[model samples]
Target: MKFKRYASSFLLQIALAFFILSCGNSAEKKAAEESNTETTSVETKQKTILFFGNSLTAGYGIDQDDSFAGLTQARIDSLGMDYKVINGGLSGETTAGGLSRLDWFLEDEPSIFVLELGGNDGLRGIQLSETKSNLLAIIDKVRAKYPNTKIILAGMQIPPNMGQEYTEEFKAIYPDVAKEKNVTLIPFLLEGVAGMPELNLPDGIHPTEAGHKIVLETIWPYIQAKL
Candidate 1:
């Protein structure tokens, strides 16, 4: 019933998967791999970068290695920086869900936490007020748990299914939350890749490997600044 609601919005034969059941994402695997090979005091001292969001952050239809989060790890490793990137992107996640699952990721202190939800909320016509509340709550949770953790909010946009007024306001959610909370904001997570058919998979929802590469660039500037 839930999928049926959003699937109707897309005029395509392929169902628009707002929530593709993701078994797991590459970010988790990469984080585990790094943990396994790492043993040095310096590695132990490395700061953590947690990319917390949905399928985009998880690399979705593409190989996890091709996801933007994976590219970020590669870049960090190449630079010999002491930061580990963990992709906490889950498919079919919303702001409320992200908030609920946030505590599990908080067991360890992360130097940075990137929030990348709400697109799913927008797709489902969730109330803007509720979405905003959840965003603030998630940020607050991290701050309360780890005062020193820097936060970055990734802005998201859904197709104009709910009307232009709603779409415009929804797009503003990211900056609004960022300003109210004083966290860094990535203006649009899918800046160059969102609607481009070549950049997305056949589902027309998830990004292709090339798209993730582009996404990596969109997010790198913000991610790089904190490093």
Candidate 2:
């Protein structure tokens, strides 16, 4: 009886030790998996450059991939950049509309912000002061959200039908904003593509695929400098 009791006690001790060791191994494995997951999340988080604008930035009638922003993304990939380009464009979006939604996009905390709005405001003949105010507000909001973020303002122009005075005023808005905000400026977003029938689509407003290539060329230098 004494021998049997001693044998039973020894077996129980062995079982308890095995159980404790198994639990320790499981906890260690779980901790390793969690650490790996956290490392992957940090490694995959890329810095972002946000392009915010109207249909011109949205690629209008063309495929989204053909837009200047998309082409810019391809260029970034080709150059093996660690930045992600986000096209935050919408068709027929006005300065006011952009102003209202600017906060939403800013939530992502972009490293660089390309402001391309106000074209629709110009086309619609909205007051230049109002346009300027909205744009200034956007810049202020972006600065508030990301104080160190680099900002690029794309200049836009209205057609002569809007009258030479209005057109000139519209053309001056971008450079003026860039000066006041102390931001970089792309002299004219549509420069070579604007007046050329071959470069524009049927609407003569948005750029065709070929035109977007030109647009890319115009802005690439400025963007490269920023990057």
Candidate 3:
């Protein structure tokens, strides 16, 4: 009887040990699975779309939320696209200024970069050659950093006050750059918004909130095409 009891007790102990080890293995597997799931979630968050430009892009003279960039983001979100739009615009930013800071923005590795500069340069009556050179350099740096990034050049026009010759050349810069770089071109960023008294603010330079909506419409087609 004593021997039998000892054998039974040993078997029970062995069975308990096996059950404990099995539970531990299951717990470890569950933990590893959760960790993998968390990693995947982080990896699949969203891609970035960067808008690099001047006051027009920065939504100068209006609420930032009412800017074209913000409106565009709202539209994108409504469509459930996995993209995050970043407004890298600065008020009164010239092409030279943009070029100087382009390297810092390139670090973000945006999937799409919308170039909207040179308007300020034109307004300031900066030399057309210098403006074009700065813009070209900016594009080159962007290409070097993100080879596969899609570039959208937003064309801008200045008032004819700077002389018809300067105006024409300044206006041509965008299309020329787009053609040369083989990037997508937004023919005219302020196409419908420009010269419309109702669309513009008192300054007649920056667009009003209503104007930004039109701006969004102007660029939406190009942006959609890339997606």
Candidate 4:
């Protein structure tokens, strides 16, 4: 009888051990499943951004990560904001080129747009009317297809060599369009870096890496307000 009791006790201990292991496995599986669910939720909540512009937007002389768009995206991410900025800048893209591709970009239906065009038009001495018309067309298309998308028109200034009359006409185009279209206007995208040699790259035009920082500082207040 004593031997039988001992065997029964041993069997009970074995059963208890098995039950504990089974419970532990179940708890581990539940934890793993919950972790996976949380990961998926975070990924799904990410936001999308669309950036439209020229070489300035593309980070010509600097690493892609140092570009204005890149810096802006990093800022958004660091701030723990849900956003993904798509870089749509072409090396020598003009306002006309951007207008041509409006239909294709509109398919994404971005939540916001950083409109940084027209600089090449000014550099190339393109007709102000033509430049304005192209920008206006882009604005119209954006308004029609994605009315809720907030547009931040990044403006540009003309060089003194371009002459006062021509420069004024070119400069006026941005505010005029933004006013008419009711979009947010960031006057002078190169605000602090334009005439400052220290802030400019070798081209005497595009901003250096430091220049991009200035650009960020100049537009950040406006961008934050809109956000």
Candidate 5:
């Protein structure tokens, strides 16, 4: 009888240990699952701010981080805003090129879409009508894919190297598109930064680091209000 009792006691201890280990594993698994869920939720909460433009938006002469779009991202992060900025700018990109490749970026719906093309078209002396048509088509595509995406057209202007007639017409393209589409229009993207030698690189086409900072300020008001 004593032997039987000792053996039974030993078996009971073994069962107890197994039970404790099973509970510990279950608890750890539950905690890990909860953590993963929380992380996914945070990621989904962030809305996207798409900056679709050309070399000016690409930060041609300076570190991309110094671009206006980059600054906007930094500001959003610092404020803990639930928004992310996607820089879709391509160097030497014209409105036609932008429209062709827009579908790629539209895969993910953006909360705000800042259109900043046409400067290249103006510089190249592309017909103003063609430039305007391309801009409209691009906006239409965005609207079709994501109707709720807030569109903000960044107005652009080129030097009289294209002639005063072309220059003025180019400048009017943005507002015209914005008005027709009934979207937000940034009066002048490079308002304070343009024509300032210190703000631009030797090319005078792209803004320098300081210039991008100024550009950031110009658009912050519009972005802040949307956010």
Candidate 6:
């Protein structure tokens, strides 16, 4: 009888150990499933936006925190939308530079693209046709990769110092590109903010924090409808 009792006790301990192990495994599997569900939910909720531009878009000479892209993201979040705005702004980047990086930027498959280039090209007096060609390539590439992605072209102005003929050509580039590509255009990104001294940065080129606000207001209507 003593031997039988000892044997029974040993079997009971083994059974208890097996039960604990099974519970742990089950719990782990359930947790993993929950984690995967959460990930999927977050992904579905978020939309990806790629911002490709020059100094203005890069928030040149401004704190990274106060850059236009940062402000736009903050506004997006405040509106309670799930979206990711990727900054691909390269300071001093011309149209050619923007085109060169197009392939790499498209790898992430952005749902929307904000093209704010050509300013540097204008500043440097790059050939108009060359600038247009580079922009065309980028537009084509984006359309091919993500056909549904919304494209917003931010237009720029040439300093009167660059000959009136050159200035007119530069000014025309934005609209022509937009029209040819059939994409939305933000004609004169600076709009009300550009010439306003109070809204501009110390450099007299980049926009101040207040300038960024004005920008948002300018672009908000069109962007809102798309969003």
Please give the clash total of every predicted structure, in order: 0, 0, 0, 0, 0, 0
Give one digit per residue, the lDDT tens place, for model 1 in 1-227: 87887677664434434233232455677788787777555466868999999988888877787899999999999998978889899999989999999999999899989999998999999999999999999999999999999999999988999999999999998899999999999999889898899999998888898988898999999988998
Model 1 lDDT, residue 82, Cα:
75
- Model 6: worst 10 consecutive residues (lDDT sum): 61-70
Quote the lDDT for 185 in model 6: 91
Best by TM-score: 2
| TM-scores of all predicted structures | 0.80, 0.90, 0.86, 0.79, 0.82, 0.81
In terms of lDDT, the best-performing candidate is 2
The lDDT, on a scale of 0 to 1, for candidate 4 is 0.86
Cα shift from native, residue 223, model 5 (Å): 0.5
Give model 3's clash tally.
0
List where candidate 1 sits over 4 angstroms from the true fold: 1-44
Off by over 4 Å in 6: 1-45
Q: What does candidate 5's lDDT look like per residue over 1-227, in tens digits?
A: 99999999999999999999999999999999999999999787879999999999999978888999999999999998878889999999999999999999998899999999998898889988999999999999999989999989999878899678878878888888889999999999999888888889998778999999999999999999888
lDDT of 3 by residue, 10-63 (tens): 999999999999999999999999999999988997888899998899999988
Model 1: worst 10 consecutive residues (lDDT sum): 14-23
The CA lDDT at 102 in model 5 is 95
Name the runs in model 3 displaced over 4 angstroms. Answer: 1-31
183: Cα error in model 6, Å:
0.3
The worst-scoring run of ten residues by lDDT in candidate 2 lies at 102-111
Q: How many backbone collisions does model 4 have? A: 0
The candidate, 3 or 6, that scores higher on lDDT is 3
